[model samples]
Target: MTNETEVDVIDPVAQIESYTKKDFQLTRLPYDFLYGLRNNKFQYSQMQVVMADKASKEGVKSFKQLYKDYLATYHSDEQMLAVNYTEFDGQPFQLACGSYICHDDIALLNSNGIVEEICNHPVLPCVRLVNIDDNTEKLIIKYRKGYKWREITVDKEILASASKITSLAKYGIAVNSENAKGLVKYLTDIEDLNYNEIEEKNSVSRLGWINNHGFSPYVDGLVFDGEENFRTLFNSVKIKGQIENWIEIIKPIRAEKNICSRIMLAASFASVLVNPCDCLPFFVHLWGGTEAGKTVALMLATSVWADPTMGAYIRTFNSTAVAQELTASFVNSLPLVYDELQILKDKKSFDDMIYKLCEGIGRDRGAKNGGVQKIATWKNCILTSGEFPISSEKSGGGAVNRIIEIDCKDKKIFTNPSELVSEIKQNYGCAGAIFVKWLQQGDNIETVKHLRKDFYKKLVADSDVTDKQAMSASLILTADKLINEIFFNDDILLSVSEMQSILTTRASVDQNRRCYEFINDFVAVNYNKFNPEKDGYNGEIYGTVIEDRIYFIKSKFDAVLQENGFNAKAFLSWAVENKVAFTAEGRSSLTKRICGKVCRCVCVLSVEETAEDQLLNNEDLPFD
Candidate 1:
């Protein structure tokens, strides 16, 4: 039935023998041949003859009838043949079906072995099934297009192969009609089940999911798991000097016994979660003095998310605009930690940008025209420093309502953080594990509310005006959350009590003055009285009314007099020299009269006023 191959004499024999060895056994057919089999109609004479002969032997009227009979014969019982298929590279053998075959067995094979690899079936083809060690229950399947034999123990797919085989036979091509249907169905079923499992496994993979810069989709060279214990997460301490003091800084905050304080903290966290993106964009203002371990606490906060590189830390004085631009690329990660935010100029422009970047939708102007383009909505968190709670430009809106404050200054008052940071750095991984566990234990909003309530209960006695203000905001934000938690109640909309509580508290006059220093400067340089076209007061000119000899000094007197060529210095000198009811205190009062009289003189005798005087006195202009 097969031809024997000579080891050396015949040139054709040597070539054929080498080709038949292991490498070319299943691969002798060219790639184009397989391609043709898959894409072209299967109507070749060779397949028709085989089907005709099989049909005649079985006394069937058609090829379809013969295939049905073949399948019926092997429907209940089937045997799996064990074979080692190998590929040869010059002389070295690559494992094929599971091992090496002698040269003698290679020569006896006809038309090569294993036709499935070269077949074009809609269903995934199998090359060989190996027992794979003592585990005969799990078979190693070498699929047609796959790189290696996969181990499988499921039989649901194997049991459903009968129908698929019958369908393939009607079209042509050679098939072991006896077992093709059962084999094809089993393979298909297994593939579907296997894919579903893979998807589920990958869904819960949290590695590199949380970070400081934002949320990274992928991270390298890091081990992540929420279950790791504390002892295993840290490293050995180099106990000495400032390094010894770092751990001391973190102790009190870490060992907080009051549940209310943590609830407030959780409520702060929930404010962000109310609209948290995968990136978690939110800002937390942690204001305090030095040695408070504010920096160390920030580091601990990041540990909960795992990986410091995921977050970026910048001092308050840095250009916030540039900071926003740089972090834009990584917004999908986690929170952007703005350290020492107090250094930024307390102006509306700078603060507003930060405000919008935190809770408002970030937007930019289009390059060609000034078209408004909204940036991708990100959930990045914000952390900054300030002595007092900042007010939002648009108060009472949900955006500003989400911000929560923590009084870290009080807790870290006497504590030293030098040693705590050293310990935390060494055991960063351990800290992260603990933080994750803490988050999973309760509803985050409720947890934060408790913290805030307990904190106020403790400080109700000596709380300063600043603390009271921040507490009120926290309470309002909490009440909003509680309203949602308890189901929307009609009481939320009926009263001005909530609004009055937040609006009534005014900052101290000294504090207000300091707070608006930047705004006042902006106003002074650019303020103006109403200009119909310009929509506000024209700040450039001091308002002046000119009529006859008296002038109404609505604004800058010096500039107004000088523009009229009145020899403002000479007039002041004359008024003083003549003692014409004039005094240093009377200058403004007299100036107003001088401006008003000049205005009236121009109205009654327009020809008497010079061109410069007409231009200088806008009060007489018809447009005014």
Candidate 2:
């Protein structure tokens, strides 16, 4: 036999070639040969045959056993095989390395696999494996570090290239290292894994699992047996509360004499369940004086679904319309509660927000890759509170009609508002779940639709409420009636009479009514200026009281329109069409002799005309 030093000096590749010429049953070289040749390590190559021959003489059962023996002799202790065991579907399995990730049959292996079908593990945890229709697959890895999640999709064949591995490492992942080697070995050894092909489907807007039939993980009441696909994936959180405790605490408030507050809370709960009903999503605003418990009413409504705290379920109106749209999209079918509309002091922003939210869809955008971004959409109720009504001089008929303004009658709707708030704080979110449970017991969609339609027709016939305004009231009525029957055992009913009173009164003061009211109030406040006898110095009587007709100077009338945020030309045209004001020549401004002076003015015929004709003209306005 040659000396050990001389054997180390021998060319292992030449020796292997000579041995292949002999009658040896070796079909191919071992996997370690490429590594040894790259490292210029003749020692590892020299030991391969000795280890294989020794294993064969010792009656090794398989090539894996021989490979293990070779690793034990040459590799260090840290490089030795380390196995971890886990069970999937009640089947025992072992993961021989740490870097490998096997989710079913598809294993993402490291660069050491030296195979065409393997892919390097991504740096980030987010990975999308898509199997196309042509029997080919694509792996897209999104890296979320300092910036937003960015995508890098590649084919399976590119995984074996050194340049591909280097490029991936630049984005961050270890390649050709000890960790990669172990990962390769572990992935290659997994046995009998089952994997289902991932097919592309329509993306859900919310960040949780949902089925095709609208059954969602976030939704409380749903019973269907089908696989849920997480189009916009998110982890579920464990909520802590007892539904029984909540129902008991909320019973008194629900049974209280404040029908507006009770209806607001019930309608908020019913909003989530009304997705199956064919009606547009609408808003409810609790409006009253400073101490009228409007905030408490909004809190009661918010307590149905989540914490009534400042930022939990009840959010401030200090954000932009874009932010509101995003929040609505994030919550999806849940109720969105906004408190203190006074915080949104920007009149234009507030007006835009009201219109955009009632529209029920977000603005379309373009993605970075030049494709149209997924549009965000939601259908849900928006509950708001303010010291004054939501429909103001700046609001149009469309915005006014979409909201049901419930005026809180009393300064204190609850005897102990603090206790009610505390009870709700501890026991919130359960009533919403209970409401959902009751809704899921049977199909109530047709009943809800019928009740809404019937109520809509009744309100339209009984009063001057617009169709959209009547629709909002109808939803509230349906919710209150259903909730009283289901949860309250029909003990208290939010009667159609009460709703009729509230809606008719609220509808009577819509945009035109408010505008007319604003004109009267302005005239009353500036009566001294309009009266030539009171002020003593007058070039032309701006607003002169002549007999019964109140004549307003055209310039002063336009100034009032500008001060009240009404479009001057549009209001003038509207006033002319409605006969609220008229000119001598049927124009906006007309020269007339008022109190012995020629002046350009718009003549208000009577105070009653402003109120009556404005309503008639506003009868066909669309509030959708």
Candidate 3:
């Protein structure tokens, strides 16, 4: 009997397997046996018998207690196990698990012999488990914010530290402190688990509220919400009224009777639609005197995508260039409208703003952590309005070329401004959506590019419009033609002649012409200061009376130039090259000696003569 008992003890597999297969009630398992099964030294069948026998002998009350104790002892010493999980992007990640356990509330199996459940605890979507030894492990987890992801690594000691769950929650994880051990165990044991499986699928993108998949938080449209490979349509925009109301509001502007209104409204809609095509972004500066319907035109433009309220779709010039850049980035691919250009305090900032907007990219900047920040970029039309043209006396040809200035001198463009404004406030943003939907129907981007190129070449060949201006006009014309024919059923066709006339007017006032205009305006405003016969003059004449001769105090001349956005030296060079101003000796000079002191003076024909000279030199000049 002693020898037989020794044999049974020595080879316990049969007993263990038999007890495991039996339908028996048990409570506890032997520590050594549980540990062996956890470490793969014994099979699961052997573990069952050891646990049942131990529970029976020790009076373990319930299977739950028995299982919990078994797991505790099994996972006491960290052991590496294979784990697999799928990321939010549907990518698979594999790692070694260090420990695992069944959750308390989520029961999986509640049979006579076995009770199992999964750990119900929030865990890092992705974690790296490394075994340092039989008793120690390291874990690396990935934390995500929007499109950016960061990895954090910690040892077992650090993970087990106080408030570990709270620390993890700071990184977008939610886990109960009591379940931390179980979570670690489950992650270590599970061979396959979906880390980011959610009912509603939403992915992160680098672009501001606008996703790379062409979904924008601000614009109403169809969005694909799910994994990139699989997506479902979601209507993102909530319209306040029926689409017919919007059409009713736009009908008056679109009617053939109001050509200016039709052209302006079409251009506004075209601006929003042209973003998808391959073309350079340009500005449409609507300028005229007070009450000339410039603001109404701007409101018309703003109504295409958003409310025309002062702070809604239309931004003001009161903001800094940096703010504008950020706003441009946020609006991505949407027309940016700036109202009342006169509010721009600094001319240089305005010039920089125009160039930056036209360039379609922001300045390179560094982050707080010494890393370079992502540069903001956009492709869309910029609409601006003011009493005066955006291109001023100090603007360069490059800056002037990027803008298509429209003279909104027709104050009667809208019969009742108040009523029209009220209509637009109630009915807007539908046309923009319609335009986007129309574009998404087919592959029309290539067609747009081809048409833009063709129009650009034709404009260059037929008119004196510069290549850049031609490019800008061509995009608008192409969009106008397509929109009139396809979307509006050819209601308001924007002919090449109209585009040519617009470009011709803009081309007439180049940088040189603007400088001359500024000079004339300055002389007019300070005529008394320059004339000896005027009451303002205390003593002698401030300017030369000789024919084709003009003299100004160097200090006063620089002040005027600086106030108008011109660098005196550069403007002098430009003036001399253009024959707008010259020195007495027929030489190019910015400063000369007058009254035993250095002063600035220029010899030029009368304003009338200069206008004639301009017309003779540039046939594109609009003035006689």
Candidate 4:
């Protein structure tokens, strides 16, 4: 009996093999026909709705119109026929001729069979379809910079890939997999094929990709050597029944297609943080109630990374070295997990440092010199939690867009986390193997999207939510990359309130403030970084944190009251006047109110003493 449900599995080649040698004729369909059919299937029909939405956006319309306008302007330039550009092969090619207003008898430009070549291919039909506009004449001629134009239908896919590739390439990661998309499509077409086998094979291949792109291992203390030993450690366990359960947790029942999830697992395996430059300052947030597995999710993510031994460093209410170390480590990779950040007293300076490290320009000189001599301005992802969003007092500049958030709501610990960890390591082959499979599956992450969206919907429906800091920074970054890859052209409105609400719910107000005071003390000890440009000025930098009124750090303000100098009490008074409230701890009651008020005394400015005056009137006072 012939089973119609059976999927035809073939080698990498796009050939349809029979179930049995006697099942069908040896050569009924031509190879080229099968190959083209596989490439141009309607399997992505579900994706078309999204594609049409993107094409209908206002910015997309503007882009198309702009190109049309540019082309129309060229039509009037009689002197020019068309513009010319070189192909990838470096051959001179003429673009639409332009107006040679200054000088030129004939249009002295080389014209290849480019125009005819373009009118007949995917670049014209499928790729260029995205350039569709209400005005057809203006739309067709606007995009004139290519030997082969992409088809609109397929162009959407290619453009999405191109944009992602370009963004990554800027950071020096080039993907030369010409048929990578086609290959993925073909492989996925096989039904009933063991997905695990495919995932493992692909995971290994993705690891090699990291090394190929010049990303060295041990970024931020995480190491990924692509060692066979680690691979064995990952594949030792089994996910047999758990797969179906996990799939159920992902809402919508059906997984959405996206590229971010693929990269997450793959990059995690390679121990390479996928920093998509196009989405600068990506924001990832974990929000939900307590015991929701937010921390566990972060741990899982970190463990899967190439190396988790030094993947993070936890700081306390008063730790200077930890802050410096985190700032310096961000340059290469690894997330700076600021645990229990809500317990500190000072928040201003601490938040300022975090903001800059997350989004501001690269660290100051010597920032990357991770040793004692290093400066503090390197980039990094910060993970923390409290009851509210980190405020400006605790935030240096602003929350970087690169920050990603995840929700760990309702996550229970019925299963032993250690056991799960062991199982993952032994059976799944760890990050290197898992991620390789994800990458081999190509950049499709509809599954993750559906999961996230379902979670969001559930939260909207529920009222008893807790643990707002359930999401991890990595989760947000992964989401952003996926959104960009899947809905690059879609005009979706994002709510700032949603972002702020989630962040505020996680940060601690007092602990965040104390972080500021610590920075102030460090600067006081090392004053060269903030010396005033004046003489006879005695002002000490005051660091204080407000209570639940605000979360996170504010800024470093100067206290002008000069007492026993460095008076903690008097400084607190000044803070009150400026609306900054904080308590001084571990100081004498008298000093507590005027802490470190004077950093430099007026007498520090010694004008050159006149020799004659000093000789006649100067007398050394004997010390008691």
State the lDDT of candidate 2 residue by residue for 460-574, as single tens digits.
7857667776777777777877777766663676766777776634445455546655776677777766677664666445667666566788888888777766666765566
C-alpha lDDT score of every prediction, in listed order: 0.34, 0.57, 0.57, 0.30
Model 1 per-residue lDDT at 441: 51
The TM-scores of all predictions, comma-separated, are 0.36, 0.63, 0.61, 0.29
**What's the true lDDT of residue 619 in model 3?**
55
TM-score of 4: 0.29
Better of 3 and 4 by TM-score: 3
The residue pairs found clashing in candidate 2 are: none
Question: Global lDDT for candidate 3?
Answer: 0.57
What ordering of candidates by TM-score runs from best to worst?
2, 3, 1, 4
| lDDT string, candidate 3, 1-624, tens digits | 123234334444543433431222432223333334433323443444455554465454454345544444433322312211121221233222323333222222222223344333223434434321122344555544445556554544545544454465565544467655544445444423433331112322212124234435333332222222211111212234555686667666666345456656666655654465556678888877888777787787667666776665577888877878876765656677788999976666667877898898899999754689778787777888887878765777678778888786745667777888888788766766666666555676667778888887888775677777777787777767776665556356666677777774444545555666676667666666656544555764355434445666556666777777666666666666656567545544457555456666654434656655565566534332
Comparison by lDDT, 3 against 4, better one: 3
CA lDDT, candidate 2, residue 324: 86
What's model 4's lDDT at 353? 48
Q: How many residue pairs of model 3 clash at the backbone? A: 8
Candidate 2 yields a Cα-based lDDT of 0.57
TM-score of 2: 0.63
On a 0 to 100 scale, what is the lDDT of residue 122 in model 2? Answer: 23
